[model samples]
Target: MTAVRPWDAFTSAEAEVRAMVADPRWQGLSLHDRAHVLAVRILVTPDGDRWLFGAHARWHLHDPADGRWHPAPPPRGTRARQGRHPSAELPLDVIPDGPDFLAEPGSTQAFIGPDVSERLTEQLRVLLRAAGRKSELEYPLTAFGEIFASDVPSTVAAVWGAIMWCAYAPAFDGNERLITVFGEYLRRPLPGDEWVRWLPTPPLVDLVTLVTERARAGRSRAALRLAAVMADTAQILLSDTRFRPRALALLTMVEPVLREPTLDAGLDDDEAVRRAWLERCPARLCRALMGETDREAHFSHAVYDLVEALQFARDPRQAAATFLADLSDSRGALPARLDHRLRLAYEELDRAGLTGTSAGESTEPDGFPVPGRVLTMPAPVTEVAPPDRASAAAVLGAAYATGLAWGGLTGAKVPERGLAGQAALVRRLIHERDDDHF
Candidate 1:
């Protein structure tokens, strides 16, 4: 057994943890127990600044010299107060009476505050001293690094929001107001610094998880609001290359809830409702994935996944089918996918003889052929041969003339060339038509 000294004990708790793990006494302890002990030691430190418990509380420290545990006095400048309210204190609550910390409001403070940082360096040292401790040691150290590197104010608010919604009930009577404030903060542009860079990932994941759990448990409004906040934050963070992929993954996970069929009953129309819900999904996904050097290859992966799922839907496929169909109809092509389904749809149309061109021929360049008798805005003056560009232009011009004449654009006495002249004629006609019988 290695000898443990006061310097070694105070320098790295993680090192001490590793030494303990290697010790015969700790060999039988489960990983959870190990984590619990590490967490308790972490909480006992003076980090996590939320509630101030005066420094200098006596605690056990393992002595390396004799390979045995010893009573260590608290570090210098530390003095315990007699009447401090333990509940209101900060770091102390982090090491609660139980093994696992509850998702209580005050608990996060211990994990995120300054006191933890001081002890983490020491903790890591201790954990590194033992076998099979490297992996576990790194986890809390990384967390400590993230906490220390985070924007304290924003992180605190986000953590507080998570606690409010998840751990505490009656989450503030003015929860809506609080949400609005946080939403505004989310909308604000953050700087492209290390602190802001780490800001979104942890908080966003926490919010999404909390909202999903609540929504699953039947809190619809809270879930919706949480999702909205998530979407908004995602929009802001999409600019950051490092965080986009994970953000997109979380957004995709919650998309089904937003698109739930039952959620559509309150909308103005089914199509409008569905489009509004889906539009944001792609916009946010695209915005986040586009131009990302690491993630560019998977930029359209989400859209393709949704398309494939829609094509194979076994039940209530109508909703997904209708969404893709409307997108194709209005947008000319599926925004992300490679257009396999589009080709199939066109082939089906051609097979039905709706399109004059055979499937075997190159009837149209890329999209569906324009209808022949739709009173094309500019009618052709003569029969156009195949691929006759000039002739096609003339035909279109004639169609435009015919449309104009049918609408009285040329027949009116007003000037006839420019848009201004056409507008004057249309205005006179509108007054005359309304004044007249028909």
Candidate 2:
């Protein structure tokens, strides 16, 4: 940490910051207690400028004369001044996990200027220490190093964003906004030297756990936004061999949310971000997702999610066919009815112009691809393949492979089952879940 501190200009930089937030006492705090530090705003100014932090909507300036910092008096017009807020008072324990990320947005100062980055850097260090993230120590340092040199604003933003979001999520009400800021920053082009080299650092895997646990508990938006951030971070690292595994781990964590049946994954605008994520996906990540279709992780995903993402593939058709084969080859037996429905759905899409040979482009909206496990199946009218004796299990006890395919094609949506059919399909699915718990 000292290596990156600006020693040339500020003769007593390190001493000043340490005085405000003592190292020994800070180090003794647990994860939850340290997390309350998130409510504090620690900012620094340009090199050679004053250092500061905020609490209770007021500011505290570091006093260089005495090497200690204290809250300043308010303006003359203000009423009796209040002492330090309860948050500033050290509590016995600060629980790390909670229902929301920022249940309490604390601040003592109205304005904590930007230069306190090094101070923020110290806070981040304390966090890692409490979380036992010795492996991630260097990342915050890199962030501070860049901010100190005034080199790359983008890199600084990534580091700050990752750390802050980690501290503020779930119980922190401001988590959504913080996550949004982080995602937007990462979406821009951050070179290899700027961010990815720091990937094995923080946001650590703890964030992944947070999203996985509370996503369904009304934090879906926050969770998905973080997913997008992780996705964007993964995109940045895609080309770097050193960080590629870390990138893959990030994407793997979001797969569950991507499998939401509504395809919204809890957000209305999830599709656009979802598409961008799919386009940047590495083939290896894609294969790993397909592997998750085995019996054990079946309920872990929505059947059509991966299939829908394949539209952006370099070879959409091949990906689709392979994924189809993956499903067939996976653990449970493919219900012939559903398999036939899926093949027909693919056939319909082909007929509608998705020759399964699209070159990484959008498929026709009306192409109508169907998933094996759909809440509602599009009612398409076509000639059914006359079943062979064994294939027609209607009267038989056992069955055999039927090489024969469906008969001559007919056309048109079943007019009788248009909107009402969809509504009925949903009703059935809802009732099944409600009644039998299936």
Candidate 3:
């Protein structure tokens, strides 16, 4: 296979950036900098578009008048090039600083990360509104169950929209679509025999062991994929008294993957946020479902990282201390819809009783006292249990069935079993678990 040149990866976008840079307005500029432009971004503001070229660890704004490579204002509370993720195309603080930019999904230099999907958010809110119209209808679990079980066309569409949202962030919220999908799947009415046939006798213990061993053997990516299966089934694993221990054990295995340098490269590097356990077990587990090298998912990871950071703060006042120090400036550039999303996150967290610090409460060593119970990360165990192939196959079958439902709704082509049959199908798709196109 021929390699894709970075410039060729997004031909039209590159052409547009090139055209902007080559305009006669920049003719008077004298440039001696030999460094190649590694990334290109266009910030859309009410005044019009301002083009930015990133090179040599700094972003230079293109000035039409003088064409000098003048420094753009540094992001809030951070020095130039300091605290950026190792693989980040641009600084995290700068991402939420303007209206959302279009990214050509697969390009490494794509300028924007995924913002909260407005359509999905709107659709989901409508569903919640209907569910809450009656005082007897309890929100979240009861509402989610009703929606998931309904075959009503509009409700189904809402469910799929939420599913796409979750697949994007995998776990954008601790109690949103991620919980709805997996929780509904677990709570769906099924015959005793059907339940027995689908899950193993010991629930997901065998599969959990398989994932743990894979993590220990340094097959982190593969382990990540398997752990996602458990994540999808987490409503059962975490909620059921029978399997909570196994869920905790699975959590123990993938916790390191959360803090893995490669994964953390997509997260906030601010020590205050870092010390607050921004990436929790639920968030990381669902995130592992995303593609390894997918730019779309990587950007979504970046957005989710910010959401997690926002969650870390006890309140808006607390957030202003660090990541939100320049909130006023950042919000000025944020699109109205995107601004609404952040506000919604705050509302949801507040409703869950998850946000806020008590008066005069002493802070933890990290200076940020975690608001809720923190699950202890367990020590690694040495004994190995052979994976039950039967259980793995059953879980794959469940996942395949869900894929088929989605396929039926979208009328999109899905992968078929090849000559190697079920195993081949599993091998083909396990890596691309949350890839919509796949």
Candidate 4:
């Protein structure tokens, strides 16, 4: 490890801390076991660094960016005390991803006050070291690098938000207040940036697993809130090129959930449930099928329309017959695979006695061709589309990560005044860093 200690102005119990928590004997323990050792108290900084206190009041500053500890000055201000100090005993959940909160007073001091157990600091060292190895990110702790120095504040905020959400989701408890806070953050503009990036897949998996557990435990409100946050996150993933592929992956994961009938537990009206199901499934199916639209655009989506129609009709068998007749009219021009699936679908319906006529039967002489797919199928009713089960659950995993990040960084709200506000924050950080240097 590098040994760049802080300037003499910074007071710390670094030597004592190292001797206590970094013992050679401790080195033999696995990271997981070391994490559970209760030995230090922690203080989190507004900018996302951590202050670790070990035995005999020994303390060190941990820069998550470098996975290194430095001598730290004692806590001196309100901001330092207000910053999050997660229990050393609880499982570590937050990632130290950040757009420095230099605008907040005492944000500098926010790096020093804290409470946590001993092995926890050691566990964090292990985590930060692992993170440094695995992630391509090289965040700045004391200076603005080329990428961040030139970027706009909004981009910084958005990227920071995305990283925090994706990284810290495993610790999210699905609280409604936190969900509201996340929703408000989402309302801010999230322009994409090339410089800052992270994989959405791992967090997505982590979140989905958590939500599945919550749902299994019958925590309906928590499950729904978690799902809502994920859906909210999808709005960001869909708009950014960097995140679109992961967004598509999210859609694929949730497709089965969409295919199932909408739950009637929270929903009261059968019509409302069907309408909600129709609204979510079709658009998702279209996005998923975008890669398959080469031969016949209309025929490629025939199955989705059939699914929608079957979902809405009073008698699914009769609905299937009507859809097959529409399919039969265009059968000659259909893609071979689509033609094959359609044939199988027709036979499946025929076997169930759901078809009104054989596949080759002629259409009614005055039959108005069902124009523009199943959306125009003989119904005149219109229903508003709202978030439902599958739509919310689609991005659940990612949402939880981002949500926890937000909760952890509750002290560092992004400025609303655009570049001027961000410029000011950066200036403060620079001023603080330069002023503190020997």
Which prediction has the highest TM-score against the true structure? 3
Of models 1 and 3, which has the larger lDDT?
3
TM-score per model over all chains: 0.18, 0.19, 0.21, 0.19
TM-score of 3: 0.21
Candidate 2: tens digits of C-alpha lDDT, residues 301-342: 122222223333333223333322322112223322222323
* Prediction 1 global C-alpha lDDT: 0.28
Better of 1 and 3 by TM-score: 3
Runs in model 3 deviating more than 4 A are 1-155, 166-438
lDDT of each: 0.28, 0.29, 0.29, 0.30
Indicate which candidate wins on lDDT.
Answer: 4
lDDT of 3 by residue, 279-383 (tens): 343332332323222324332333333332233223321221221111222123211212233334434434444332112111112332122222111111111
Which segments of candidate 2 are over 4 A away from where they belong?
1-137, 140-179, 183-301, 304-338, 357-438
Query: Residue 20 CA error for candidate 1 (Å)?
Result: 54
- Candidate 3 global Cα RMSD: 23.5
Candidate 1 residue lDDT tens string, 298-351: 212222222322222221122122222212122333222223333344334434
Residue 216, candidate 2: C-alpha displacement in angstroms: 35
Clashes of each: 34, 28, 0, 14
